[model samples]
Every structure is written in structure tokens, then in C-alpha cells.
Target: MAFDWSVEQIAAAPSITPPTLHKHYFRERKPRAEVRFRVEAKLFTVLMTETEARNVSTIDKYVKHFERHDACVPKSA
Candidate 1:
């Protein structure tokens, strides 16, 4: 994944593991500007075994629900 290298780089710089780096910066446990950038830039990855995948899935589900709702609602003229 594209973020793997970035994560590794970040981890190396901080002397931490990639997963820990992800937990602190990439996970949606807290709202962060960098997280939003990752989402917008498609720089994040979802691993099936990790909690990040579940978090990402939750965000995706909400986004899809809003998209459906927007499609069903009429726009104001």
C-alpha cells in the first residue's frame, strides 16, 4: 500500500513501529487534519486484521448512507 512506505518512514523517524505510528496518527480514534489528508489523498490502507479497517469501514458506511440519502432527497429550486 502507498502509506506503508510513509508509515515506515514516520516510524523510523520516531523509533516506533508502523502499526503504532498508524494508531497515533492515521486511526480515526481522534479527529485530525493529517487523518483527513490521508483520507483525501488515498494514502491510508485498511488491513483486515487491524482495528483501522473497522474504523475505515464505519466511515465508509456512514458516507454511503449519506450519499443514498442525498440521492433520495430533492434539492431546493
Candidate 2:
């Protein structure tokens, strides 16, 4: 699923800021699998990537994201 919302609305909804720093809401009943990594810096950052369970092999689903980030971008299909 794809979601696009404004920061203004997210901030007002719920969070941990003066007005509350709420960003997004994607409450899945159960996540099929997950992959997490850490970025070392002044402060460590955790990146959690996930996908839901499906009967067939969704290679395309995973393939598209290979271009989603600069680090994961592929040269050719």
C-alpha cells in the first residue's frame, strides 16, 4: 500500500514533540518478516525494513525497491 500525508496533520495527531512529532501510522496485524540495520554516527540510527506474507514469491516486489534508495539502486533490470 502507498500512503502520502502532510507533516502538519501527522504532527497534530499524536507524538513526542511540543505539538507531538507524530509521523506515520501503518498498523499491520502481523508483519511476515523484517530486516533491521544500524547506521553508526554521533548517534546510532536503526532502519527497519519489512514486508508482509504472501503465497507466491514476489521477486518484483523486492526488485522494485532495489531502486528505491541510492545505496540499493541497480544498474540494469
Candidate 3:
């Protein structure tokens, strides 16, 4: 007999991994923009892991949130 799938089971699978402290050390100097983006992404990844909310929609929300608020201030040329 085949096992039947349930709504609860499918919904429970949020595809979230536990937040592991990922520290990347850079020996050489790098561009400010690149470094800033990496740091932001890493922090976002950690938060997602902790919350167990890894869906694309949720991630997109965080990215937008950063762009609107937490991200670096733009410098007018």
C-alpha cells in the first residue's frame, strides 16, 4: 500500500536549515559595497535559519526590508 500525503505534512516542510555561525575572514582589502552586501546576506541567512522561515517570499521580504531601512545610505555623486 502507498502512503497518503497530508496537508499538515507538506505545510510542515518549510525547508529551513539551522543557523550555523558562518564567519568568512578576508585577508585582503575589498570593495566597500561587496563587503557590505556579504555581511547583510550572512545576517539574513542566520535570521532565516533561526526562524525556520526559508521560503522565497519571506527571504524577499527581508531583502526589501534591508533595502528600505537597514541597508547602507546612498551617497549622491
Candidate 4:
């Protein structure tokens, strides 16, 4: 989903100042699944790189931890 709200649109909303909007809700929200997928893709790339470079041992713990995280984090509605 996309908000597609411009700064002017946000600031023009009832009782909302640009500074207030920025300080409180500047960043757009993303779904948990999207975030997880991006993270998994990046991690997979790094894992493959490390394996090819013979440095997989260095990130073994991280791979295990990320696997656990993937198993535990639920998809957002």
C-alpha cells in the first residue's frame, strides 16, 4: 500500500504543522512481509557472497539467528 501524500498535503491537514507531521509521522509505514522479504533477500545475497569467498564460518551465527527470526516473525495484515 502507498500513502503518496506530499509534504504540503500532510501539513495542510487540520491542525497539523509541517514540523509536527515530520517529528511525529514523517516516515511511511511498510508491511511486515515486505520488510522481511527485503531483509531476507539482502541476507541471502550476503550469505552467498560469504560462502563463495570461503568466509561463511564468520557469519554462521548470524545466519542461524536470521533463520530463527524468519521462523518467528509473523506477516502483517
lDDT (CA) per prediction: 0.54, 0.32, 0.48, 0.65
Evaluated at residue 36, the lDDT of candidate 3 is: 61
What TM-score, computed on C-alpha atoms, does each candidate reach?
Answer: 0.29, 0.21, 0.35, 0.51
Clashing pairs in 4: none
Which model, 3 or 4, shows the larger lDDT? 4
Candidate 1's error at 20, in angstroms? 53
Candidates 1 and 3 compared by TM-score, better number: 3
Per-residue CA lDDT of model 1 for 1-77, tens digit only, reads: 22223457767876999888777866543343454456545422333333554676756665676467557655751
At residue 75, candidate 4 shows an lDDT of 57
RMSD of 2: 12.4
Clashing pairs in 2: none
Give the per-residue lDDT digits (tens) of candidate 2, residues 13-42. 454342334223344212222211211121
Model 3, runs deviating above 4 Å: 1-27, 53-74
Worst 10 residues of 4 by lDDT: 1-10
Flag regions of model 1 displaced more than 4 Å. 1-54
TM-score of 4: 0.51
Say what the RMSD of model 4 is: 9.3
Measured on C-alpha atoms, candidate 4 has an lDDT of 0.65
> For model 3, what is the alpha-carbon lDDT of residue 52?
85
